[model samples]
Target: MCLLLRLWPVLSLLLLAACDQNQVFEKNADFDSYTWTVQEKPAFEFEIQDTTQRYNISFNVRNASMYGYYNLYVKHQLFGPDGKPISALLHQMILMDPQTGEPRGKGTGDIYDHQFVALRNQQFRQPGTYKIVLEQYMRQDQLPGIMAVGVRVAKAENK
Candidate 1:
């Protein structure tokens, strides 16, 4: 009975953590970007309050550029329940819009390729849950095609 009593605390903690790991993603196909747009369907979204570590976020796209080249322009934002943006996923590589100096590209794809990116070395500072906002930051603005996305949520090492 003593062993069972001691194990209960650990088991309960594990259960709680497992529940917290379950993310709720909302697909929003609405953004104010002129050059970038989501499909007529829904966008893949992951809502997690995980701040203690990094999570793998991803999605797919179609008919990106006029050259038939494809890429993913993804934007991530962590918001509170009140819908105020908390944190953002800012890229250092820097993608530029044709008319703007502000780096506007999200994720770039290999030549004529369809695959996944790990977004390695991604983590959050806190442990609270968050809503991960993802959308096509850019694509072939002249024509219409499609882009798909995939995201894998994992715990960071220290967390």
Candidate 2:
């Protein structure tokens, strides 16, 4: 029982690290300006290997607790291998509950982290280079309280 207790923390850390190692591609863009403007579209480029394999795609956003709104809207654009536009989508993400005003995601001090799934069980039509661009769609000319934005693509686990 003592041995199990001593090694439990180490074993748990290893298990958590192992779980996160399945990411096919991940990229994060930090906004040094501390503001996300409509013109300041952040782009992430990644290559696809196997078109047949399905993957889960999500957006990670970090914002301060003082973020004035309970939700955020973003415009997403995807470009294909030939540099042609593939799809354009408007995504609405809820950051906090409207009724309670309670925040979502892991928080430390004033900042919170949120992961919104943009695509699930999605497969690329072709194996090639792809580009994803994101822009804030809020009414403000320069949105505040946004710290960083990221994209994580992981291979789907067999069900």
Q: What is the TM-score of each candidate against the true structure?
A: 0.39, 0.85
- Candidate no. 2 TM-score: 0.85
lDDT of 1 by residue, 18-122 (tens): 675532231223223212344432323354465555555433222233322223445656555555675666332222344543323332331111223335445
Q: Judging by lDDT against the true structure, name the best candidate.
A: 2
**Backbone clashes, each candidate:** 19, 0
Model 1 residue 11 CA deviation in Å: 32
lDDT of 2 by residue, 1-159 (tens): 766653453355346546895687777687876777778889999889889889888888877777889999988898988899988899999999989988886655666778888978878898898889999999998778887787878888878
lDDT of every predicted structure (CA atoms): 0.40, 0.81
Once superposed on the true structure, which residue ranges of model 2 sit more than 4 Å away at CA?
1-18
Instruction: Give per-model CA RMSD.
Output: 14.9, 6.7
